[model samples]
Target: MDEIVRSNCTDRMRSYLESGCSLHYQNISNLRHLHSCERELEDYINEANAVLKKLQRLVEDAYDATLTANLSAVKVPDYSTADSKMNHEYHFTEEKQEQPADELDRDSSLVTVMILVHNMLKLDYTMQEKIVRSLSLKSSSAEIESYRLMWDLRPYVDGSVMDLAWKSCP
Candidate 1:
């Protein structure tokens, strides 16, 4: 990889030097550099895509779990605990009533299930963080190298490489 990159850099530098200040040389150099780095770019994309696939599966599992919960007759309870000042809110007054014990149990169970799922998925969440962090490093390095190459060839062009990059994306 180093050999190929050095050779490509040398050849491109030679071409730009020989052509002097020419837009045609700059365009060709840009395109050639892109072609040379195509393999590396693809590899980075493949790695990121692998991570994305894992994330997608996790998201799908969460979606499926939610769907299953929704379909069940068992109702999950809201688990918001009463504050100190709101303790009297649970007290039965002449105009108020209390809920059945079973209903309260169901609500508590829902909170328990949610907590369990969160705990179980902690590893996946950590893995996701690691993947994204590594992917960002890889992406940043590629972008920096591309920018360096573009800057090296800047003198030969009338416009910025960003214009070309912008056009390619949208």
Candidate 2:
């Protein structure tokens, strides 16, 4: 992974830590705990959205750059004055386009996957937020336990994508 990508990933990790989005309160037995959980959820959702917006912009810029470069590389062979296209002789020389093009494609794909993973994380955060909001004093122990398990376990987060991101860590 490159420096920019590695540090962007670290930025995300820092965001998560700052927001405390990855925490779970298994036992919210009182009003104070409940309100704190609610506040934490709100903070988490806001922070997650901010991170997602930044990621989206980065992804969009990468994709747009790739598109612009690809468009410039594509050229139409002009044969307006030629009698027959097949009979016309053409000289083709591939001028060192492979390496840069391959790198652009890789970067584009990386940003795409990064956004996808971040969006997955955003959705997971939303789900946890909903669970937190639904909590009440009358809620059953089983339901609270289930919610805690879901929030802590994070079933919605794609492990493979996260693993790839972690591999980029410096």
**Model 1 TM:** 0.27
Per candidate, the number of residue pairs that clash is 1, 0
Residue 77 Cα positional deviation in candidate 1, in Å, after optimal superposition: 17
* Angstrom error at residue 112, model 2: 2.8
Q: Write the per-residue lDDT of candidate 1 for residues 61-144, one digit (tens) a residue.
A: 755665565455345335554354355655553134234344445544444444344433344444433443344324677766
Whole-model alpha-carbon lDDT for candidate 2: 0.73
Q: What would the per-residue lDDT of candidate 2 be over residues 72-128, giving only the tens digit for each residue?
A: 767655667444553544332344667777877776667667777777877887787
- List where candidate 2 sits over 4 angstroms from the true fold: 1-29, 77-95, 168-170
Q: Please provide TM-scores, in order, for all candidate models, with all chains considered together.
A: 0.27, 0.63
Best candidate according to TM-score: 2
